[model samples]
Target: MEEEKYIGYIKYEGNLVEDGLMDARKQAQALLGFDSALRHFIGKRAPDFRNLDFEIPVRIRKGSWEALIPETVGGWVQGGLGIVATAYFTKAAQKMAEKDFSDFGITDLFKHAISAIQWFVRIGKHMGDTAIRSFENVQFLEGNTLVAIPNDSGEYLYVPKKMLDLYTSCNPKILEKIAENIEEGRELTIGTIVNGKVEEVAIYAEEKGIFCEEEAEPEEDVLFPELVHGDDVVLEGEVTRENKTSNSMGFKYEEHILTAYPESGSVVRYKPLLFLKCRLYGTVSRLDEKGSIAARRPKLYVSHLEPLESDREEDDLFR
Candidate 1:
């Protein structure tokens, strides 16, 4: 039997997934163009890594976002005449091409190099390594590429213009059916939109706000470590005494009160605090109103954290 290969799309709140995919596409475009320009300069000749300005690590300011010079150079390389890397070439062509060196006599060396660069960039961007910010996914279908964008908190799949024809074949119901199956007898993943909007019921259950009795089974117990505080702490934690508050979900929560904090840290819970359901090391961000400490949560990820000791212990004892 021929297995049907399906391309899925997820639409999330703030359109993060889509935004991420778009950012990747934009970066890919810029990088591909720059690579083309470089190849044009080194066409029919072996690529000289010494002479090629692949990308320079040019740090701007004391602590600003550090992007490769190729990013800037690529921007320059794009010109008015549909010239992809013209902007970069006009500004620093002489300087970039100053040192001449050559190696690897590959045919269509420039084209091949550009293609390779694009592949790496695409993979890196989709894997969330680049600066282009959109929460979306990309897939190739029927000789056309599709970028799925989010609408509301619900997951919506999208495809490139070339993919519209396959819409009938790509039924959205298939996704819902698959999701239903995944959620059976299982806690929901955070940030997974069903029909749009955050899965509040699932989130609350995961947070231990509901569906937990005094003598709930150990497996049902929601145990998360208290967040670690401090900028270097990496995991965003707030030393809030347990307090009462209403979350975005409109339900009053008895969660530990979190105050002004900076950075996203490790997630104490198995599910994410945000709409997206995934365990990742994140820093807590301080939510303030009128410059006053309001609440903390909705953190960003700096890096993954070590698994909680409890997790290790469980693994050892169980498995």
Candidate 2:
């Protein structure tokens, strides 16, 4: 079956003021009002705006062209012209606002509506130099190709398919592991290479684990790591600590912590096993906030421990 696709949108709030003139408290209230009103209008929850402050010059540039209609026309004709002018100006304002907010990483159906209208207007006006200039100004708008995906934190992460492709290309091994785990029906988490180490971005599991509730379906052709979690894999690391204790019921248990320092050190907790001076292999069952495999309280459980030979030469060789 073909997978369903969606074009996501984010909510944006901005003060219509010049730079260095905003009252932060007032702006905050306005933003809150705008968000609330927008939610009521759309009948859905409002998405967050990018935290950066935005400033747009409040100047109105006048065009060289003058109205051709004669002033001798009756008030009724003038009234009709007034209505037309107001409608067009309102539309233009909306278009400009949408473009500005989308630039700051916020989008919504209303913004999309304005964007679509502007797109059509630009295409329709292609024969004119004015349209050409307008098109040029908006040609780089991200809404032309990008879509938003809300992560576990209720914050939308804009992921363009192109961006995802670039990330996957950087590490094909991670993608392969993800595919294998998907086929096996395991929980999935999104991770990326940070400083040559895998870092967790999103986690998706049903057992009240970390991260937000999964709402959207995963894209079939491209997997978003933030929307999915879990994959089986082997990791090699040094055993850092080991402990054995008995529960209140007198049931004995054992715990071991391993630290792997490939490019950077990552700690992993696993069940008791034979001690080896060399690194041991295990699957990543959970990850911490830093994207390293979680140790003390792991969501990604490591299993099937086995030791690997050390790369360092024995001291006896120098003797």
Q: Which candidate gets the maximum TM-score versus the true structure? A: 1
lDDT of 1 by residue, 218-294 (tens): 32222222332323333323221111121112111233222221223222222222222112243543334555333
Worst 10 residues of 2 by lDDT: 244-253
Clashes of 1: 42
Off by over 4 Å in 2: 1-296, 299-319
**TM-scores for all predictions:** 0.20, 0.16
Scored by CA lDDT, what does every candidate get?
A: 0.29, 0.28
